[model samples]
Target: MNDEARGAFATRGVGLAGFDAPEARGLPPAATGVRVSSASDTVSRRALAHGQEQLRDGPVADACSALLRAAAGLRETDPAAARRALLAAASAAWSAGDHDSYRRVFAVGPCHLCGAGCASTPCARGCPEAAWRDHRIGMSAMAQGDFRRAIAVLEPRLHQVTPRAETDELCDAGSVALLLGRLPLARRLLSLALASARAAGAETAVPGIIAYLACAELREGRHAQARAHAEEGLVLARRLGQRNVAADLSAVRALVVSIAGDLPTVRAQVAEVLAVAQPHGLAQAAFLAEWAQARAELGAGKVERAAARLAPLVQPGARQGHFGLWFLAVPCFVEACVLSDRALDAPEMVDLFAVWADLGADPQAPAQLARCRALLAPADRSEELYRAALAHHERASGPYEHARTHLAFGMWLRRRRRPTEARDQLRAALVGFEHCGAVLWAERAGAELRAAGEVAGTGEAGPLSSLTPQQVRIARGVARGATNKEIAAELSISIRTVEYHLRNVFAQMGVRSRTGLAHLLANVDEDHGRGWELPDRG
Candidate 1:
């Protein structure tokens, strides 16, 4: 683990108190009437039923404790039932937003048969129900920054082709997958879990699963899908009185609308989420809500206000956002800092972002990192960095992020007296924003284009603008004397795809050769009152 990761955990007061404590072998002190012994199956079953009843009624903390105790009582008699009970405990703890209770239940201590906490795969003592033991150890390893071991241990348990596991079990795996940055796996698992919940008439489980699925889609850049799922989940959650799940869904909706630059909707969703999240200790929901607000602020050009708003969340402090979510917003925070001329205040967070980028969890991390470097780099170095960022964006999925990069690069070009190139980049950004329904950002790009001496959406229908965005990119690559292979590499597409686009580019422009294409582009540049000059990437 990196220093930033360690610092984040330390700041969050995350410790293995329950994982190593000997008292973990017994039922929680607050949990009464649960007798745990080798022959307490009937008692354990009753406790489990009571705990489930508590989940539907009230006092969720008591339910978690009771479930944990029931799991212990059933451990020696029925391994499957014990696993189910433990899974229920995890669900109850999560819905209550009780992190401490979650940790205490899942971070089981030493094995009853062996002194060690089943640190080995099979447990040298051949402990009964070693799967759950290994799972607990793996979870603890993850909490303690040993991700490699955790993945090795826990990943296999979730590898079933068509998982028919219990709803809570699937939900647990889905949550872990998300935390590990395995977006596709998280989506698949959670989707299956949602189906299972619905089929079993587990209405109480449905809202939380939908919330998780929405979160997965949001991170994967399926914003419209995320909003739909979040909206559905929010309705169900509110109807069921599951305020914590409702808060999470509301936060997800806020984030989705924020990307579209809908400030009013963002503000409304943020208010709804914070009202529940802050009072219920839903740190994940609160973090997403704050991030959505900061992003809306940044999009609206309130850079200083955005920076100030994000400082407490990204900086190392007691009030820092949830460890899982704070890193996701670091790129935005870095942009706000750079735009506000508080660049020096961001290197630490950037270093943390570097750690996140290295994890390869987020598909857009590489591009965002490049953009951050471009923002921080000197003028002589920033252009190539911006180009590098654009190249990275070609391989990523987020249209909003891709547009942001183009907008930034265009602003830089315009400031450098490269008005022609700035117009091209700003126009692309405007198109991207429009495609994604980001009205405010599209307007921002339009204004930038106008400031660069090219009237936004009012060109003489230039040949280059007539081409599709992909075709324009291919045509530009050809005009720059780049080979098909080179264009493929730059665009993160196949050479065949580049060649196909290039053929269409030639036909659309009525050009017979590369030289003709180049000449035509040069003529377009001359029309802008300046001869074309190759960009000096150095």
Candidate 2:
């Protein structure tokens, strides 16, 4: 251990020199004030201490065992402590991919002592105890495929989580919320826990919370923010000697870079994650690493390579990746398969993706699923599917994906000898890609536009072209004669933000008034042969 790690362990009363010595087993030499009334208490305390040491050192599977022992020893005497220990054990087991150990932790009922279960008590809504109980029951229900019950039990509990909740309770609730695909709720709860943990100097908890927070941001299409948090979390995890958390953070970085079209960075991050994740049985991290690599390949236009890379991860049976994450790769897999002349191999994955999409967790899934179906549909039917995909994209915040749909539809139109229609979609796609910093995708769309007999515009293509996705939406709202408050409510943003983007929109479009902006947009729509629809305020 390094000086920093030793110092952290020292704060827990564990000395660095004799951590593994038989005589230094229970309560380190620095421990003096601890009270142990019974043999079980002493053993439980020792086991808990040892488990924490192992977590900070190496071999998390062993840490799970130690924590489980601690929980069992304290089950009857110290129910609260036992519950904490068990939750810790479950986390360790999950990281180590120890299925039996994880199941064992969950099998120990919601309450450590009460056989009547957690519902029997009339606890206040945001209490730490109630939060923990809800987390446990919700997780168990999810494991059992009772997703409806799980969401019913956990969604309300997420709202109940407050700054007053314990760090562990907050982390557990946030993680559960994330797994259920509630990105906003997960981000809010995890961000709160992260701030609280940082303020409390809880270094051990910060890395994990940051990992989850990065994932939530990633899912929400905040790629830049996700990468920033992932990088910070990686540094801290490595410094704290938490290889598993470091691997997870590295995987997150890989995903972020993959979307940004940084192939070299994606490969490097995936390599770093896999070197630790594969041997440590960190399947979630490993899955992410491999998925990111495939995504990078797809973005680089290596269709066959991407399809081959994703095969094992998304296919059924033992070779498949993490259950929660495998479906995420299915859209890419379907597109790759179609592009590689292996369309027959895509239906199963697309069906699976649709099943998950129906669960309504991932906001991008519906549009992506539509695109996948469009890829597999006949040319006669593909246009309607692509249109449906675009309609779905209007409701979500993922510009990269929305652009991909436009790009695909444009490509399809070009092949059908409809250059004019193709040019419109390709132009929108190029703008979307450029606005989102997807350089490779933007180049692809530009090339398509050029091939369709149009010189790609050097800078802004039109008045609305220079505006961002949000800016464009706000401009459209003005054209539709909706007030800033109406647009803000429709977009779930503050009216202040709506006004801010609107001012930028007006400035960019060279229009001082909403009436002028609306007239300008109407002229552009007539020239372009398409209409930009805003949310219907009526």
- Per-residue alpha-carbon lDDT of candidate 2 for residues 284-349, written as tens digits (9 for 90 to 100): 678889999888877766667789999988776677665445677889899878776678999766
Instruction: Report the C-alpha lDDT of model 1 over 382-458, residue by residue, as the tens digit.
Output: 99999998998898777888998999999888768798999999999999888777877887787677757774443
TM-score, one value per model: 0.72, 0.72
State the C-alpha lDDT per candidate. 0.71, 0.71
Model 2 earns a TM-score of 0.72
- RMSD to the true structure for each prediction, in A, is 13.1, 17.1
Question: Per model, how many backbone clashes are there?
Answer: 0, 0
* Model 1, position 360: C-alpha lDDT score: 53
